[model samples]
Target: MTDLPFDPIQLMREHPEKMHIPGGLLTKQGPQDYVGGVPAITGTLFFNDAHTAEVREAICACFDEYEVIAKAHLTWLWRAEPPEGPDKFVYEKAPSMRAMIKRMNENDLVSFTYVSGKQPHDAGDWEFQVFGRRGWEAKMIVRGTSALRFTMPLLHVEKNPAAFQAMFVSFAKRLKALHGYGGQGLVLSAPRESDNQPFEAYLANMLNGLDVGEPVGATRSAHLGIKTVSWLTAVNHKMIEKIGGLSAIRSELPMDWFALYDYGAGLVVQAGPKPEGAPADQPKPARLVLPNMLFKEVRAPKVSLHYASKEGEPRLIGWGAEQWLQRFDVPEDEVQAYKARLLDEPKLTKATTLPDRL
Candidate 1:
C-alpha cells in the first residue's frame, strides 16, 4: 500500500477536534471533538473455509488504507510454556489464508467477535461480538447484529490453546498489515481463549500501553479508559462538588474511572498503648473499601496500569487500583469512628480542627 501523507498540523487546523494541541487549544486542552462514526463492521467466518482467506485479505487490504492513530484497549494472552516445539500457534495448520479457506470446506472452527480498534467502541458497554470459524463444531458461533453481550471481566480463554492461536494469528497478521500502514482505528480486544502467547507477544510489541485514546465511532474514548468513578473511592461528581464546589475542579481529568466496591471489614487498632502498655494496640492492613476522604485524595489513583511480562516483550496490561472487598467479609464487631459526610459535617464542633473549613 502506498504511504499517505498525514500532517498533524494541517489536520488539526482543519479539524481541531482530531489534532494534537501545539499551536492551538487542542495542543494544550486536548482533543475535544470526536469524529469516528462508521457503523462498525462484523462478520463470522469459519476457521477453515473457502471464504476465510478472502475475508482476511479484504480486512487486511482495507486496513492498509485506514487512517492510523493510537488507541488503548483491553488485551490478553494464554500461551503455555513451550517445551521444545516450533512455538507457533494456530497459523501453521492454515498457513496461507487460502489453506484456511480450504480447511473450512472440510470442517470449520468459528471465531467469536474478533474486534478491531473501531469495533469495541461500537460495541460500547464493552461487549464482545462472537464469530465462530466453522458451522459443524459447537465452536461455530452465530453472528449477531451487535456484540455478544457477555458479562463483565471477560471470559478467560486459557484451556483452548489450539483454537485461540488459529484465530489470533490470522487476526494478528491482518493487524500487522494495518500497523505497517499506520492503522489506528481499532482498539485491540479479545476473549481470553483467543489470545495465546505468540498473539499476545506480537500485540505487546505493536502496542505500548493498554491505556490509549482514539476516535470510537461518533465519540472519542481515551485509549486507557476512566473506570466509571467509584462511589466508595473518589471519581464521583458529587464528591468534587462538595469538596470546593464545582468551580474549583478542572474542566476534565485525562479520563474517568470507577471501581466497584462492596461492604467489608478488617482489623483496626482500637487505640495505641501508652508507656505502661506493651508498645500499643495491634493493627493490620485492613481489607476495607470505604468512602474515606483519605483514599480519594491520593494523587495518581489510577484505574488502569501498564503491563509487560518479560524483559524484551512489549508491555501488555498492568495493575490498576486493585482493592476489591467482598460483601460477605464485613466484621460483625467493628464500628466506624463516624459515617462519611456528603455535605460537610453538621458543624457541631468548633471550626479550627476541621481540614477544609473556610
Candidate 2:
C-alpha cells in the first residue's frame, strides 16, 4: 500500500471531538448526535478512460495506507458496444462488499464505490462517503459523465475559519494535481446554517465588504434619493458584470455583507459593522435609491457617463442632473428645467455628486 501524504489517524487521535466521535473504538456507539452547524467543503473532478485507472489507484492506495478503515458500497455500470444494439447503460449496485470487490477486480466493469470510516451512514444520492476519520467526514459520489464530486465536512469552520480556509486551499491544490483534470478546479462550501441561499449569494456578501470597501449595516436605502441610487446602481452593475457575476466577485473580495437584492433592476446590500482593525481609508457607504427606468435603460450599450473632479469640488462629483436627464433623451429645455428643480432639493443635490474617492 502506498503511504498517504497526510496522516489522518494522527490528526483524529489528537482531536476526536472535532470528528464528532469518541477518541477510541472502545467507546460504544451511543445515541448519534446532530452535527448540523458544521460547514462542508466540496468540489468535483472529471476523469476520462485514460486516467481512470490512475485515479482509482490513488484513492485506493491512500485509503489502504492511511490505516483508514472504510466501509465500501460499490456500484457497476455496463453499457453495450455501439451500432448493432441501442447504446443503453445498465446500472447495478452490489449487495455485498465481496461482490463489489470482485467486480472491481474484474477490470471490465465500470465500477464506483462509497467508502467511509464511520457507520450508520445516510447520505443522499449525490453525497459521497469520505474515508478519513478526522474532526470531519468526507463523501464522494459519481456524477454521470465521468464526473466525481467530493464533499468534506468541516466540523467547526466558524470557530477556526483560518484553519478551515487553509485546509480547503491545500486540499484543492492536491486535488488539482490529479491526472486528467481540467478547468480552474472548482471548490464550494455549503451554508453554515440551514438558510437555503445559494453559495453564490453568500460569496457575494463577503465580496461587498472586502472588495468594494462597503460598511456593514450600511445600505443603499431609498432615502439617498433616486438620482444617486440610479447612478451608483449603474456603476456597480457594470463592475459586477465586468467581474463575472456575484460569485466571481466573492472570490476576489472575501468580506461579509448581505445582498438584499442582487438581481433584476438594482441591488440593495447591507453588511455588518467594519471588521476590527480595518484600514481607516476604507470606503464608507452613502444612501441612494436607484430609479427603475434608469436601471432598465443602462442595461443597453448606448448609455455612458464619466466622473469629473475639480479643485474644491464638494468632495463629491458626478454628472449633473441635467446631464443625466439628457442621457435619458429628455428635451434640452426640459433637462434644464429638471436641473433647476433639482438644485433647490438638498437631497437631490447631494445625490448627483459622486464621492471624490470611492
Could you tell me every candidate's TM-score relative to the true structure?
0.20, 0.25
Question: What C-alpha lDDT values do all the predictions have?
Answer: 0.22, 0.25
lDDT (Cα, tens digit) per residue for candidate 1, span 62-148:
222221210123221111222223222332131332233343442333222322223222221122332222334322322211101
User: Model 2: runs farther than 4 Å from truth?
Assistant: 1-39, 49-51, 61-121, 124-145, 159-358
lDDT digits (tens) for residues 164-202 of candidate 2: 222222222333321111111112111111111122122
Candidate with the greatest TM-score versus the true structure: 2
Find the 10 residues in a row with the least total lDDT in model 2. Answer: 209-218
Off by over 4 Å in 1: 1-186, 192-210, 213-235, 250-308, 316-358
Quick one: how many clashes does candidate 2 have? Answer: 14
